[model samples]
Target: MASQVPPQIFSRRRRIAGLRRARVRQAKRDAARYILDDMVEDVLDRLEFIRMSPTRVLVIGDWTGTLALSLRGGGSDVTEHDVATLDEEHPVESESYDLIVSLCSLDRVNDLPGALLHLRNALAEGGMMIASFLGAGSLVNLRRAMLAAEPDRPAARMHPLVDNQAASALMQRALFKRQVVDSRTLTASFGSLDRLVSDLRDQGLGSALANPPPALDKAAKARAGAAFLDTASDQGRVLEIFEILTLTGWKN
Candidate 1:
């Protein structure tokens, strides 16, 4: 007979699945507002080193396929791969792309390093990659609130967010040359706590926690609302942090 896994492990997996489903649902609902346009400008701003015109490009996790469309607008042949379901170990192809851009989507991937390697392989020797992803500094206030609400919980109520240092390390280890990494924190304010939560739902953020706290029951929801309201500023705005890191490297 196979050994039974601990209940906690099973619970954690279930929570992760629930979070993924919630994110997919949100993606379906808010695809237009949350996709390409939101991150493409930032990606382009950081891709200053790349020549304006490239022959072929590949985009991993083409959420809303905005990047692909943008590259096409710039007159490059573009191909897209949605890595969420495909075998991450084998992305698309090797040495085929002049540029590969990943935007705000790699944090949810299970094998981040492997994905990076696959991306590198997909690039020609001189090809460049410009990637932006959410960093660990994101959701500090929310994380603190959750921790305070459940001080004894072993795991975080949100997914494991990465920091700049960790992201840099991942990039450096990916065997790329001319590596440059930078991070920035964006603060978006909400008129009310409920709107903040709803915005997160709309953006498909924070939907991959291990053993996430159960959905807010009536009393729990009341408490959470009170807590966020207490933290509101005099201007009646509550802030949420989005820590984004941009990494650039070239295949040697």
Candidate 2:
């Protein structure tokens, strides 16, 4: 039996380019890393509560390298890799890592189900995988703004994301034991839509569509900016919501 290939909705090259741009951008400016930070904290907290000390660990998307640094301090051999160029088909060494922690990357993968399977395969029996990424309810403000920009016809401004239910289904299909899927909401305030976009780019959250829509025209840009501002609260800031989905599973 031949394995089916996942649809090519996202372009890994585009995402890698965005990550490269973010690396340089971060060096120049102190960029917002809330999403990555939240994921790191969640992983750390989970490890603490579970009281699991994995010696062979793989850390992905630790852009600030802080997660890897902290894990290494615990006397673990950690293999770090940028999430941008990870090939879902061959994500990691098979049955090698005792623990795999990937942050803010799964949402952009073209073959999400396949990616989960590869992650499960990479784990030794009973080894655990912890992954967190932006989920379905993320970027409400941006989504509204984009919709207002093209009232008649909207462009593909963002990638479709999985919710907790879809994540749980994927875990089950991967045959991971003791699977758990959860979602957490985080809020961030921005004075302007432009600032929100800048923050997203800084965190390597740029669009990774295979054929991204062209840039909005001047009028559309103005409309979008205005629409985004209209949603600002009394505090003169727009509160954007990010729904982070976390998946925890152990290889059977």
Candidate 3:
């Protein structure tokens, strides 16, 4: 059989643009940005709790530079590698770093298993790697709204996310020596659908699909808005949940 090529699920150009967009919006964070705040804070707390003090550290997808700065402040030499690439000559050099923390990037990768493998390859023996990203059970309201927008046949508007169990399986498949996976749910209230979309865009949650659906027309947009409104609570606020899946493991 001929070798099989991995289908393109995300556009590299779009992914980079999303990250850059998030970086620019970092200064004007809002309640929606609590996703990143919760993740980064968890990474820091885990490092402290585990008492793993590595001299060399690598951070990926840190739009705000907070995590890397904290690591540096703690006396760990830090490298902020924001570029997304996985190859033999990867900038992440094999067995180079003592610890690697990836945030909000893996979910956008075309080959998540391959990405995790590359991350593992870049770690020194017994080194640790922790990654966090938006996972399944997130954006249920947005999805429902999009479906209601196109009542007939719905087009794929967002990427499929990995749940906690799937994340754990991926880490195991990545051949991590020892791994643990868990998820956290962060919720925010929005008064309108447009506000929710704006918040997602501002926090690096924009569409990076290889074949995104065409822009919604006026009628569809109105329907989607109405659908989102249907989910609002008695207090007239829509509660949206962001499931952040975290995986922590050791390099064999």
Error at 150, model 2, angstroms: 0.9
Q: lDDT tens digits, residues 134-215, model 2?
A: 9999998899999999999999888899998899999999888999999999999999989999999998998889999999
In order of appearance, the predictions have TM-scores of: 0.79, 0.96, 0.93
Better of 2 and 3 by TM-score: 2
Candidate maximizing TM-score: 2
The full ranking of all candidates by lDDT, starting with the best, is 2, 3, 1
Residue pairs clashing in model 1 are 136-162
Model 1: ten consecutive residues of lowest lDDT: 6-15
lDDT scores of the candidates, listed in order: 0.66, 0.87, 0.85
| Clash count in backbone of candidate 1 | 1
Candidate 3 C-alpha lDDT tens digits along 148-183: 999998899989999988888989998997799988
Worst 10 residues of 3 by lDDT: 83-92
Evaluate model 3: give its lDDT: 0.85
Best by lDDT: 2
How large an RMSD does model 2 have?
1.4
Give the per-residue lDDT digits (tens) of candidate 1, residues 81-143.
554444444565457788888765667666677667878888887888888777788776666
